[model samples]
Target: MKKLMLFTVIVAISIATKAQQYYDVTKYGAKKDSSTLATKSIAAAIAAASKAGGGTVYFPAGKYLTGPIHLKSNITILIDAGAELHFSDNFDHYLPMVESRYEGVDVFSFSPLFYAYKAENIAIKGRGLINGHGKKWWDYALTFYKNQTARNKYQLLFDSANKNIVLPDDATQMQRGFLRPPFIQPLYCKNVLIEGITITNSPFWTVNPEFCENVTVTGVTINNPKSPNTDGINPSSCRYVHISDCHISVGDDCITIKSGKDVPGRTKAFPAENITITNCTMLSGHGGVVIGSEMSGDVKKVTISNCVFDGTDRGIRIKTTRGRGGVVEDIRVDNIVMKNIRDQAIVLDMEYSKTKPEPVSERTPKFRNIRFSNITAYTKKAMYINGLDEMPVSEISLHDVVFEAETGIVIRNVQDIELRHVRVNTKTGPAVSAEKSSRILIDALSTVKPLMDAPLIRLTDVKEALLTNHWLFDGSHKFADIKGAATSNILLHNNILKGATVTTAADVPTGTVQL
Candidate 1:
């Protein structure tokens, strides 16, 4: 007991000593309780702390309502335990709009609530609660979008009343986002860290680090389940990011990594790369850890591991549209545990288009060079990989993957696919279905409880395909669904099946026969 106490004391002392340079807001003439102009005073204290060298600006336990508190370089905004920082809903507080990424486009939108722009080595840490109080804007949007006739008339789908959301460049449209904005956004900054903060119920996205580099968001909890467009952490166009040990359950993706979108993104040509996400748990949302619908430049070199998705939409998803004009490649997702997935456990959709009507320019999803291995999924549906007929998914690999899904696995318009050590056990479904590829290979597959779920390993319009060591058990039907007649150079060898049927051309042999 004495040694344990000593360790705890040492750790506490180390934390305190490391925070030696503290700027207590009360000492800088900031009100502790809700009073006159505590907002400006607290912001001034944070700014002043930066001007006189950088240190930790402490927000004591109370309600500190502010418009927008801008942190300077090398400053840490540490909210003490029991601290609740409430932002004023009055839109006038945040003025002079700044450059920010909204929805998927770069715009000078409403000022982010807790903002840090072009600054270095900043942080928002401490075990306190930071709330945005954004219920008003969300409810307003949900109600406003209920009018169907107005939407059809105005070429709008949802939220027709609000024709557009803006930074109020003209000052008349009203700052809806400004009311309760993105809680914390560090734009074009570097060496950032947002750790040990419980940020909840933001009006907009929780933490968006745009065009920044060297970001480390560790041990943070973001819980906002009702707000629209409240993505937990969107590192748009940033590089060298590490997000780990976080609990994110929002209305949107837990953490969406983006480069850019469409013409502006491709012209700018800046890709988000070198991202690592691990040890994270996500509740209900669009996707657990997602990559682009907005990556136009290029999204590459991403690795996600040691994650859990509970009742979420998907475990790992990569979505993009046709005209988005982004190339997502070189991705690896492994060691993931999932349960109660509504859709496919691992889904690659390049044709995720919104029903909202707009001038059709180029809105298609292009996906290639992806890999998922070492994942165990107990899903409600099977896995899905839907590629474009004109533009196929390239260089894909799935290894050591096991599934117990209700639906079957589907792959289309792919090339250079390698499946090894894969097992599927569905109640009643087909095992494998693939199409439109070249250089395809499947080896070492095992199935269980076969009848409703038959094993169908087939190729369609595929080129140079190969299958070997495919075994089926439990009275299964092999050669389940191979129907693409245009495929060429088919090779099959060393496969075992019971009660499974095989259907192929009479001229082709059972082993080592090239088309």
Candidate 2:
């Protein structure tokens, strides 16, 4: 009897393995023409494939207009090289709101174009197009936000407390007057793979994966510009993810790694960790690679390698503020190349004050353990490091960084920072600016052009700072270290000044050791 039971188990396993089935959406009565209701046909295809165990649902070379494609476990949606899966324009097609996560909150709301919840071993691989019809949605959101006057912005989320009540969800759905966030949102899935697809024109965020695990996204191209909040690839509150060989050009962040927001994110304690993004190109975005403002959970062990950014507003941005207390640590960015960056190349602000910046505390963000190496950037505004006076940045480092900029670098509110072999070629600006730091080490700083500010180096309101081996050829004391009042314990040793100076700030307290 036991042997028979074992045999039955084996048979069940075999049947589970046989779930691998295939469905051709175009062949299964889906409309090939652009103006057809392919929703039913496509859903039928997915349903059939899902029922038959799990297998690859294939699409041939044509434009198959579809709505949300809910994925299942062990299923793969493979599209042909010439095929295009254009998502539906009408939002109501994604009705019957399902459980999903947006900005870290788990709710029942709009479905994504390609969505998988609690599914495992699912993969979407093909050389095809996933066009997120996002123009109208984005226009609405941007216009509404811009025109929304004096209306209590915080009241939007406050009014959402009515959701917990057992009301008719369909009747109380959030009105679409532009409060929507993204078009493609995949939440709470596992072991997913998306490769070799071109996703474009997202009305909101193009691809969002929240509260998932072991996901791999590679060789994808995302292009969305005519919209606001059109973040290209945002993987929030997920674990063990790898993103590589992706090209992104969007209006917002190109590749943003985030956690959840505020109370829910903190209470859940689901931090986004063990993520790696490599070999990517970002062109024209508000931030090339960002981790931020809503990251109330811990964001750690993130590595961005061999990435290139061009015409981006900001390159490496880690922004957060008070009332969103989180820990951002162990972030390493290496081999980054940037060209014509408009804003700060590397910006870290604990006070990410859009409206009014607040303090840095447990209800605020704490940034530390950030390291960057082998970076070459041409920037307009140079580098920036901003933190609160209370809780500044810590354990920061930059090695082998060469930046040729029209502006320069600004450092503030930091501790235990180090720069090794950092070279700058600037038209006009300070090469390095340090303020309110403890234990700073600058080594091998070489600059080519002089600035009107006479800033081979600049320092103010700092303590426990070290300036060594400052190699300059202009033969001027251009490096100014203005230790302000209450600034003490500065050591300048073996420093070669081309065009730099040192001054004791009139506000400098007595008994300051300036060498």
Model 2 Cα lDDT, one tens digit per residue, 302-406: 999999999989999999876677899999999999998998889998777643555544576789999999999988867888877777899999999988887
For model 2, the superposed segments whose C-alpha errors exceed 4 Å read 1-21, 144-162, 165-178, 354-361, 498-500, 509-511
lDDT of 2 at 144: 59
Q: How high is the lDDT of residue 262 in model 1?
A: 68
The C-alpha RMSD in Å for every predicted model, in order, reads 7.3, 5.3
TM-score of each: 0.85, 0.89
Deviation (Å) of 47 in candidate 2: 1.8
lDDT of 2 at 420: 85
Candidate-wise lDDT, in order: 0.75, 0.78
